[model samples]
Target: MYQNLDLFQTSGAMARHAGSRQAVVAQNIANADTPGFRALQVPSFSEAVKNSGVGAMKMTRSNHLHGDTKAAVVARVIESAAEPAPNGNSVSIEDEMLHSVEVTREHSRALAIYRHGLTVIRATLGR
Candidate 1:
């Protein structure tokens, strides 16, 4: 049974995080000219995972873990630390572009992990 396949779960979470980050980057770019609009950002996937307490422990059964099982890794939008311009807009196109590039790489890495995992599973299955 593949019910507990953590590899796929992790890859999926990474992809989702990258997508969410991309969305935030896009939003920041779109609001670059809006006065008082602060640039938004999502924490890195690793940070989010750590904060979400993922992989901190494993549960063999429903009651095995007494802690919260509802903790899901999610991208929480936060204000960027970039200083605001005279117009009070904090978004910098250059920074947003860089963030977009990082997101692209993260998404690619997630897909690669997922693909390699499938390949390994298929090889194990002799297929």
Candidate 2:
């Protein structure tokens, strides 16, 4: 029933985006010492959610390659801007930690919004 509601979809997308970012940050931190390892990052939650509505392309002709529009909507991994150390490793522990904190906050905020919206709906229905 909630699928019809845009609020639920937005909150869910935000949560997914945050989780993806957190995972990328964690991986970067884990590989900080690996030589030639480059840090990676994903787009912000708002940006991912903003472009989530694009529909999948229709296969009008056999020459057209199939594509999943939904997959494209998710965050894209990009190289981080952190300066590389002498070993050519670009992962910075301090920066990754800060990014992790931001991801946590975004996840929590999205969850809170979802819960509060449900509460308001329940109150309206006197449930």
TM-score of each: 0.91, 0.81
lDDT for each residue of candidate 1 in 1-127, tens digit (9 for 90 to 100): 4425888988998999999999999999999999999999998898899888886665556878565554579899998999999999999999999999999999999999999999999999999
Candidate lDDT (C-alpha), each: 0.90, 0.83
lDDT of 2: 0.83
Tens digits of per-residue lDDT for model 2, 1-127 = 8755768877887888899999999899899899999999997876664666444464556677884424335788999888899999999898899999999999999999899989999999999
lDDT of 1 at 37: 96
Candidate 1, residue 85: the lDDT equals 100
CA shift of 66, model 2, Å = 20
